[model samples]
Target: MFTVIEEQEQRLLEIRRALHRHPELAYQEKQTSALIGKELDRLGISYAAGLAGGTGIRAELGKGTGPCVALRADMDALPVLEETGLDFASQQSGVMHACGHDGHTAMLLGAAELLARSTVLDEIGGRAALLFQPAEEAGNGAEAMIADNCLQDVEMIFCGHIDTHHPVGHLAVDQGLICSYADPFLIEICGRGGHAARPHEAVDAVVVGASLVLNIQTMVSRMINPARPGVITVGRIAAGAVHNVIAGRAVLEGTIRSTHPDTREQIIRRMQGVVRGLEEMCRAEISFTLHRGLPAVVNDPVSCALARQAAREVVGADQVISQGFPSLGGEDFSFYQQKIPGTMIRFGAAKDPSAGPAHSGSFDFDEKVLACGSRWLATVAVYGLRYLQKS
Candidate 1:
């Protein structure tokens, strides 16, 4: 079973390195999409090109009339300069695959090739769809693909991400709530401007902004239940221009994350109340804008069990971790789960202590996990299709 992917491990490594060397950002994945299309063509797999009205690719493989299972890989890179010092570091300036999307794409392609050659489709009852998505870092790629009807007729879907927190060859399978809700917000406070020396003339926008920042922090500590996990982080703040003049306006940008739906709603309501209170107390006109990002990724129990069984077969039961902690980070893969039963597994790729976390400039992982991931994805697709058919 593993020999299929083992034979192509070196090729997968080379492809991942090539993608790492020429990372592309968000919707600008022209070269990346072209490479994927060319690979699909080489495998004789027909796929829809330019999906999501952009650079998303979708390929289906099978001959039987069975339930359709889908496998997804995000193909966007971040705007971080490479500092890994590896020979195949990013060639594109200010762009890098710090989140392991390069490896994700390569592994999915490897699975596609393996399934293309195997008789799993004949044995099972349905086909498998390979979804190469773009712009996950920008946070709308999954929604775009769903809008394009990518999940049509798809009964079950599976995706995986490389995690440096776990050792190589390990798999983390969460049965429910694998990720948190991520909502970004911006607050602009406008006030009267005056001389810095004046003590009582200006409305003091800077003072109001600073106070609002502290007050909003209480949303997590004071407003919500401490037992439930929630966070409100102010990532950026910009205000005054010069040292002598009092600024008339200030801006605050941050993100809110929560695991539960009721908790998330409570946080939003409290945030709005805080903003209103600040406006009334500081005597400044304030506007708050919240752009809801990805929702929490909740795994379907049956699908998660199928994936875990596949992982146990590929890497042994000892290596399959079923009790790993969930992450606060967001994944757009949640979008597909909203429509169909879906699960996203975490592949252990941390080779050494030197490997940094995801989205970091020095992020890199063990290449051995590529083959393991490829085999796991292919096996899970087969099992998932059969399971969905039975259900």
Candidate 2:
């Protein structure tokens, strides 16, 4: 399988570059979806396009005699302008594949090619579902796909991401709690508007909002468990229109990250307490709202072991390592895991120590890891199917 993937390495790179050139954002991945459909057609694999709001494609391979396993790849790009001066930089304005989704899509397509040519499915008497998903960056792609019955018969699933934190040829696989539960929050501080010079007439909303921001920071530090990782970052604040007048409204926007459910609840409750206290003290009406995002990606132990085995086969035994700490970053893959067992593997794509980080316009990865990623995806799907059949 690795040999076949290596033989098509150049083709995979070309696909990746083409995706990088014509990047799309969220549900607007028309060209990307069309490209994937065309490739699946060329491979003679059966698939359903126009899924998940017309941008997701579900392709199938192998005989449907046993448990089904899924292999997923996100196909959306970030809303970032290209800064990397590569010849194949994004042609789409203000849109770029800065998070290596292009590479992920290419590798999965390569894996599709491999699985289509091999007899592994016939041997295991199972099927592999290739989920070409969109809108992962917007954090609801998996949910949309699930609603469309993408995991209708999937017993287990496997996916991978490109990471510049590690060198090429390495794979990071950890058993549980690999990602954080991310939630975005907004707070509106409403006060009475009056003359700025009148010391006692106006209830200054900016001052109240600033106080709430500072207090919100303590929800993670002073309220949450010290051992459990948690963080609250206030990224945006909109308040006041004029300099001389006391503004009546202030809006604060931020995000929350927690690893455990109990911790997440505790933080929210504590935030409510803080908001109530600030409202009472400032004599202002404060509204706090939290928009729930993705849950922490907790990998099943059985699935993790299978992924590690596949990584060892694709890379080397020594190159397969545990992801040391859980990431505060969130992934929509957790939505799929809520229904079935799934594991997310991270492939090292760093060319050097100075490799740019993900979600940045300057981000670029070493293309050599494309073959390794495809091999691991294909191997894990086969291994997972065999395990599911026996269990």
Candidate 3:
């Protein structure tokens, strides 16, 4: 199976580099979608473009009679500027493939090419649906694809993400809680403006906002159960315009993350209670808004076992690590799991310790993992489909 990917490794690298050079953001993946369509066309793979009511793509390869398995790759880039200094760095200003969606898209395309070859689909005994998803970073792509029936007739699904924290040959395949639920929030505090030197003349929104931030932090440490892990962070705050004037209004924006749904709900409820208390204590009005993001990525046991088996076959059993800590970061892949049994694996792509972390300006990895990822994705899709059909 790897030999197929190895044979097309150079072409895969070229495709990846080309995608890196022209990074697009969120739903604005026009060029990226076009490139994917062009590759699928060249490979003789039949596909439908403009899925999810936007620049998403879906392709299938195999006899249409058997169970179908879906493989997904996000096709969006971050807003970070390029600093990798690679010859194939981003050509667009203030946009870069800093989170490795470029590699994900390239590998999925390679998998489609390999799976669509003659006799491959027949041997697998089922069909493979390739999902080229957009706007994962902005967090609505999976929902949109689901709305577009991306998971129609799919029995099981598989996806993978490139992880720089792991070594180049390792694969992380935990059976539960791979990622956290992300909920973004905004808090607005309205108060009276006055001179900064006046101690008791007016209501100070800066003070109220500062208090609210600290109290919200305690929602995790004190309010929530110690056994349940949760996080609340205030990433941005805006208030007074002048140095000597007390702020009339202050806005706070941040994210909340949790591994459990109940914990997520608990934290939000506690946060609202805290805000209410602070508003009364400070004699001010406050408004809170929660933009519910993606859910925690919990792997289905059967699909996870299939993914592990595929990873061992593609790489080696020794290179497959089944136990790892769940990350606080959120993945929109979780949304797919809500509709069908699916698992998302982590492919090791870390090649340089000096390179910056994911979402950073100087992030990069060895291109060798591209072939590994492609093989793994293709193999897992086949294995998952066969398993689901038998079950």
Provide TM-scores for the models.
Answer: 0.96, 0.96, 0.96
Model 1 quality (TM-score): 0.96
Q: lDDT of each structure?
A: 0.89, 0.91, 0.89
Model 3: which ten-residue window has the lowest total lDDT? 1-10
Q: How many clashing pairs in candidate 3?
A: 0
**What does the lDDT read for residue 383 in candidate 1?**
89
In candidate 1, the residue pairs with backbone N, CA or C atoms under 3 Å apart (3 or more residues apart, or in different chains) clash, namely 66-125
lDDT of 2 by residue, 284-386 (tens): 9999999999899999999999999999988889999877889998999999999999999899888764556898878999999888898889999988998
Model 2 regions lying over 4 Å from their true place: 4-7
Per-model root-mean-square deviation over C-alphas:
1.5, 1.6, 1.5
Q: For candidate 3, what is the lDDT?
A: 0.89
Clash count list over all predictions: 1, 0, 0
Tens digits of per-residue lDDT, candidate 1, 1-391, equal: 6455445888899889989998999998989999999889999999998997589998999977888999999999999988999999999989999999999999999999889888878788699999999999888899999999888778899999998888889999889998999999999999988899994788888998898888888668888886678898888889989998888899999899998989899999988998899899888999999998889999988999999999999899999985355678989999898988899999988867786788889899998888989999999999898887788
**Cα-lDDT of candidate 2:** 0.91
Give the per-residue Cα lDDT of candidate 1 at 54. Answer: 82
* lDDT score at residue 189, model 3, on the 0-100 scale: 94
lDDT of 3 by residue, 1-391 (tens): 5455345998899999999999999999999999999999998888889988579998988875889999999999999998988999999999999989999999999888778764766865789999999999999999999899889898888999999888877888999898999999999999999998994988999999989987887667878876778899898999999999999899999999998889999998899899899989999999999999889999989999999999999889999985467888899999999988999999898877778999999999878888889889988987887786787
